[model samples]
Target: MHAHRKTRPPANLGPWQRLLLLWLLGPLLWLQARHVRRITPRMPEPPGQRAGSAGQGSLIRLLVAGDSGAAGVGAPTQEQALCGQLVRRLSRHHRVEWCVLAVNGLDSPGLHQLLLDTPEAAFDVVVLSMGANDATALCAPLQWACWQSRLADLIALRFAPALLMHSAVPPMHACLALPQPLRWFMGRWAQQMNLSLAALLIEKVGRSMHWHPSTTTTAGMAADGFHPSAAGYALWAEGLSQHILAAQIASRHHPDLKPCSAAAIAH
Candidate 1:
């Protein structure tokens, strides 16, 4: 019997092959970087609240930042967006002035840059909804982590007294589910990235941070099936309310603010 020998592909690669390999590996590595950065939460600034005209002590000035979801892209109108609904709901108790600094496709880095570049007088509460766009960027996990760390540093240095709230990483795979191949890759990537973000939130902010586990309903999906609809914004508002109430009650010892979850509202 003749001995069988396996042949290796090659020690050296052609231009096209090398380019193809780089193309494939680049995204993979980039996505890994996103994962690592997102897993751990960063310590950013407390919201800076401008005194509301209603009376400085009586009002809550909230600042919201993020991508399309935070911008309420899928909603029918701007008034129905996240900031709108949140302001509306929060205003019931205290006068509210919500300043939304967000665009359609901003990720963590974009959000940070936006904050750094944009100048606002003050804010009492700050809410962050991002990371989906970062996943879209396909940045590597470690690189992404570095950015998150830098963001945290920036926040700590700049903002003060104002409360900081971060929404849990949304399920991006749901957005990609229609396209099978893309769905598999995006879903896995999103899962890993969300995990990274969760870890960070725990490590950096601890219990002080709020995480909104999205149970986004398809009916609440935007016409494009990507962004959240009005109903979806409602869900987000509900989640946020829980955190807000929890903190308010904890800080002021207000019995009314004790229960903040949707389940509490449902009852």
Candidate 2:
């Protein structure tokens, strides 16, 4: 019998066009980025328990990982953060053991290192909230895709979750905090990065992972205008919880179907 091969999605024209656009407008974008940074407030991560249990039934170990959003910077406490909301939704029918591995400013590379540094653990489900920092930093979509793949591989090797859920980068083009061309640049980059991520997931079709694109608009966010509000977290969490439950109900054994199958269609 011959083994099958999975080819990488091409280094298509989308990323190159974005790169060209960035290069042409680099100077203007840089100034805007600097100004935004100078004026933007640096909010601390919300205080809350990093680990806990919720509801009752068979065990569903959960891990939420990523940067500021994952750390729930906009919310008042950990209970109102993404992890808390996710647990609150998922716990209704199953006992959930959850822990949060997130920080305030970590990007994809930072997240990869964080996971590398943590001790081995097992999880049935893992939620990842990332890419805002990467988007803000203006990382290229192709590079972003590669880093995401590495991080996904790291997560698989370290935690071995039955399901890996990747939270969307959010719609930065509509963020209230940013101004002008900077916002425009970030928005374009963010969309490209998301497309790259969605493509990456498609490449890993055999894996039990899915991308959870933002369901709500960025207009309903927190003080930062980027990180989700408490209510926003609940909304996002509810959406994610539904997807997880649907996947589980379809096959309790493991998440089936090509990764991001729905996300590809939705995007």
Candidate 3:
């Protein structure tokens, strides 16, 4: 997911530390995975316009990108999802232009490729909602960090957004659909994945990015209990808005945003 699409991938962190221990419960977990898949309701991306303009004042362009979370799966409308809530709040004092480019099950690599294909556009702020799909897909934490670093660089070169925010992974340990050991395992992996991502942002892409979500979302907060609901989106949006407001993006201090070509930026 870096300048190395034609080169070798990053080193695996070896198996999860508990992988061997969990192997003993393999058969049970296997069946549980299938059973959960069968019973879990398939959620459709909630409906509403994916692009719009709102509020009045200084123009602040925004883009919300990632997996189904960015696509608004649980909420009935985009207006109630992350993008909608974020726009509603930001629009109060700034003219907000927003768009969402996300799919139901996209992981880091998919988003990377998708962004490369998207026409370049400048944005004042960009909020990312991802990691759950990658964690569930068993993507190694180091590899995820590698891809995510490249993603950050791509966003800088492509969109040149002054503020790049990453929302924390949703709480999967409390997902009602997953069972016992499987849930525990997934939850642990997600925690590790989040930690690795945070490290990458601070140590590598720290330029002008924010890695924290305002609140910790617990279980069963969404329509399907696997995705966030309206209230959940509102909480997340509040945190993001606060950070953006505090940054006072209208002023020039975030040199992190650059419109240089991909090769010119460090991944």
Candidate 4:
């Protein structure tokens, strides 16, 4: 017996409705991307220290990635750079094999692409210091966000450190001695970029992410008058060291860890 069935309403919406949906969803998708990016670390955490007997120690490997500041462009030697100082500090508590995968003049986008081109390997901890160059370029927020998203994807897929720390853009205004327009624009752009980065990171990673304030500057004009000198890197490293130590403290206190061996930790 064939019965007559009632036709249902059209499942598809009108053009206006579709357009409205797209308009509303565009911003939402951007925000969602930022959130997704935050949860994933761009690089692997320093390797977890394997526990030995009660009084034995553990070893860790750290991967540092970023731009000139991260690369310590003005530092005379590797030991004087940001990465070197960081390893020196962390070595006080754990056996550290620190490797820096950094470059000079890289913006957020460049760093993201570099990670894409790298081999997939895990590290114990990852420190990312990017966006300074991007600030100088005066990139739009959306563009920066796009690079950040790519970075997040790389971290999610390959290297996710047990802990990830992102440093804040340092004050370019310390170069305020320059003429009005250049100084004004550079300082304003940097401030905006920092603000955007901080907000996005906090929203996504919550407390899992740490922020290092790069307050050091060459108000007196270092050699280049652009990059920070050894003293400037020193101040930057000092601030970063404090945060890394805090993260390490939690790892050390974890029940799975054995007593830290002084010799191993100091290495």
Task: Give one clash count per candidate, in the order shown.
Answer: 27, 0, 0, 13
* Whole-model Cα lDDT of every candidate shown, in order: 0.55, 0.73, 0.71, 0.56
- Residue 13's lDDT in candidate 1: 39
Best by TM-score: 2
Better of 1 and 3 by lDDT: 3
Superposed by TM-score, candidate 2 places the C-alpha of residue 214 at a distance from the truth, in angstroms, of: 6.5
Which consecutive 10 residues in model 2 have the weakest lDDT in total?
1-10
- Superposed by TM-score, candidate 4 places the C-alpha of residue 152 at a distance from the truth, in angstroms, of 2.6
User: For every model shown, what is its TM-score relative to the native structure?
Assistant: 0.66, 0.83, 0.82, 0.65
Q: Please, what are the lDDT tens digits per residue for candidate 1 over residues 91-119?
A: 66666655666677777877788767754
lDDT of 1 at 99: 65
Ranking by TM-score: 2, 3, 1, 4
Best by lDDT: 2
List, residue by residue over 1-267, the lDDT tens digit for candidate 3. 001112111122336554774577778877888887788888898888888789998888778899988898888899998899999999998988788888899999899998898777667787888888888777777777687778889988888777788776665665656777787777666666766777777654323443333233443156455777777677767878988888776523334443322232211
Per-residue alpha-carbon lDDT of model 2 for 99-218, expressed as tens digits? 888899999988888888776666778788889898888787779878877887887776667778877777666666777767666767777787777877875632433333333344
